[model samples]
Target: MLVLTRRKHQSIMIGDDIEITIAAVEGDQVKLGINAPKHVEIHRKEVYLAIEEANREAVSDVARVDLKRIMGQLGGSE
Candidate 1:
């Protein structure tokens, strides 16, 4: 991992589009301001991990569904 120190209002750029700015520092907590395009998704590390875990769980649950039963209930060849 790349580690760099930036004071409040200082910014670090990633590629041409993403910028992360230090907005405030209070004791052990630091607030950040990110500037990026709408297509870009940004999430806190913990939140991202939780979302990833949730998605994996959802996918696993879907795999266990009874496809034949669903098809039987829906009927075939509309």
Candidate 2:
């Protein structure tokens, strides 16, 4: 893990695009502002984990479904 100390208004660049700036510091909380392209996705750790778990559950549910039977029930033939 890369750790660095940044004062308010100070920023650090990731590559050529992403920039993470220290917006404010109040007591024990620190606010950050991130600047990145629209294509980049940024989510909190908990939210990301939840999304991953949901995706895993969806795949598991799909695996348990009989696709061929469903298609046949819908009057479709392979």
Candidate 3:
């Protein structure tokens, strides 16, 4: 993990395109402003994790249904 110290109005660059800036600091909360290309995706860590979990669950459900179908075709119990 890369650790950086930035104050309000300060900024950091990621590669050549993405820039993250410190917008405000209020007590324990810190606000950030991010700039990137339209093609890029930026999500909060928790939101990203939830999306990943949902995707995994969807895939798992689809695989289970496929396996059941294959098993029924083979004259096996689902």
Candidate 4:
């Protein structure tokens, strides 16, 4: 991992699109401000992991469902 020390208001750029700035430092906590395009997604690591896990579980459940049987029950054509 590439680690760099940045003081408050200092910024680091990623590629040509994203900018990560050190907004504030208070005791042990550091606040960051990120500037990026609207298409870019930003999430905390734990939140991202949870979303991935939930998606996996949803896919697994969907795989176990019988789509044909449900369609038949609804009187829909195959």
Using all chains and alpha carbons, the TM-scores for the candidates as numbered come to 0.79, 0.82, 0.87, 0.83
- Predicted candidate 2 versus true structure: per-residue lDDT over 1-78, tens digit per residue: 999989999999999999999999999999999999999999999999999999999988887686756877788543
| Candidate 4: tens digits of C-alpha lDDT, residues 17-77 | 9999999999999999999999999999999999999999998888768675687778865
**Model 1 Cα shift for residue 58 (angstroms):** 1.0
Judging by lDDT against the true structure, name the best candidate.
Answer: 3
Model 2: CA > 4 A from native: 67-78
Give the whole-model CA lDDT for all candidates, comma-separated.
0.92, 0.93, 0.97, 0.94
Tell me the tens digit of each residue's lDDT in model 3 across 1-78: 999999999999999999999999999999999999999999999999999999999999999999998988889643
TM-score of 3: 0.87
Off by over 4 Å in 1: 66-78
lDDT of 1 by residue, 47-73 (tens): 999999999999877876767668877
lDDT: worst 10-residue window of model 1: 63-72
Query: What are the per-model C-alpha RMSD values against the true structure?
Result: 3.9, 3.4, 2.7, 3.8
lDDT of 3 at 8: 100
Model 1, residue 40: what's the lDDT? 93
Task: Show where candidate 3 strays beyond 4 Å.
Answer: 76-78
Worst ten-residue run, lDDT, model 2? Answer: 69-78
Clash pairs detected, candidate 4 = none
